[model samples]
Target chain A: MVIINGEEQNAAGLTVAEVLARGDYNAARVAVEKNGLLVPKREFGGAVVSDGDVLEIVAFFGGG
Target chain B: MIPAKEEMLAALKERIGGDLLEKFQSSAAAVCGLGGLGSNIAVSLARAGVGRLFLYDFDDVDVTNLNRQQYKASQIGMSKADALRENLLEIAPYTEIISQKVKITEDNALPLLKDADVICEAFDKAESKAMLCNLVLEKLPEKYLVAASGLSGLGTGNSILTRRVSERFYICGDGESDVDTCGTLFAPRVCLCASHQALAALRILAGLYDV
Candidate 1:
């Protein structure tokens, strides 16, 4: 029941880490935002994804 | 004879039109880092007749930076902020340019960014970029922040993209092209991303992009 990056997923009790793992996203390179707030990297393990929650995960690329 | 202010802006005004040009001339822009992206952002703003520019960089121009950065061989050994200021002046002599030869950290980011209507983040490090983005979103919540990333290697030019991350944060460059993957940055892609940052800043300044 979570919307991740515009796609709906049945993530009722998944932690940020679990959701990321399910999607095969590299946690090290991606920054996560949950409900318009940035989730600190350390909190991904504890941050949970509930029904109707929205998440946007962004990745960093190096350049000038 | 010192021409009137209107006379100085007539040519640019004719091109960009009076209204948008006026907005540009009245806006102030802050560029953090005078490297490849920062230098080009500064110069692009200058040519677009941005009213004032505040630039920060503690590094000196190195010969290696000439590959993708906006600098000349003669500029090597010069401070980046000063060297970039010189280049900006060549394009828009009347544009007010402020150069700071100090590294911008969380402590000084606010004061340096306060006067600017829009902010351009052009640091080379991902950590630095994240720091500035966090600082602006947290402290200067009202300011618009434009940043660049993923512009490395000679990838397909079409791969580079500009994305709006939030209400006031815009990111330019492909989300995937990292230096670790490409191993080197080519000039064309870097400049394309820089140009995107510059255009984003201008759009925010001109009220074309809502902050």
Candidate 2:
């Protein structure tokens, strides 16, 4: 299981993008950090998760 | 007549205590947008007697911005950076305000934000907010960043809060609502988020970094 935003999830084999999509997270509005490293916007598609990896995603919205 | 800068700051020092006042008077913060969030964020930093503030914005103060922004109606045609500086000067004359009339992009983001002790991301658009936050987290990992999101519409004030994403990165907002579907941004809600950013920045300045 991969840890995402402090929750355990069975997403070890999926790409970062795939994992985020499952949670209904808006890709354009969120920044992702993988295993203590930030995954740039372009790399989200290529970056895959591993067992016990941690992902921190913060989504942004409009209006200040 | 208004009190001189020294006397006013002295009273301020007495009120907040000398150590905190000294810390505030020695710290510097940068506000990346000059709208509702940025304007109020800048004002709070000034009122706390932060030594210097860097204000960035490229737009003019339009009538539409008057609802939530700190700009005066008469300053409509003025640049947001200059107009905010004018208001900040009156609020905290001793706080050195640097008004940079430019949009923060990937190219200029690092250089422009390198000097601040803490950087507050208060842009009005999601794209701009993401751009600034991503770049800062990736490139300038050492500097503290306090960003806002999900502060649209008339959601409960209790929903808005400051979340610590990492050791140096913090985000303040509901983490759910979006203006696209939430309708127009209300003044109290925006101000609440702005205040979160302001207070978060102050806490960072004072070595209080939780939440």
Instruction: Pick the TM-score winner.
Output: 2
Please give the range of 10 consecutive residues that has the lowest summed lDDT in model 1 chain B: B1-10
lDDT of 1 by residue, B56-133 (tens): 999999999999888999999999988988887776889999998999998988999999999999988777777787
Q: Report the number of the highest-DockQ candidate.
A: 2
DockQ of each: 0.55, 0.83
Which tens-of-lDDT digit does each residue in B69-162 have in candidate 2?
A: 9999999999999999999888887788888899899998888888899999999889899889899988998899999998889879999999
lDDT of residue B33 for candidate 2? 94
Score residue B45 of candidate 2 by CA lDDT.
90
List where candidate 2 sits over 4 angstroms from the true fold. none
Candidate 1 Cα misplacement greater than 4 A, ranges: A12-31, A40-47, B1-5
Candidate 2 lDDT at A39 equals 91
**lDDT at residue B107 of model 1 (Cα atoms):** 91
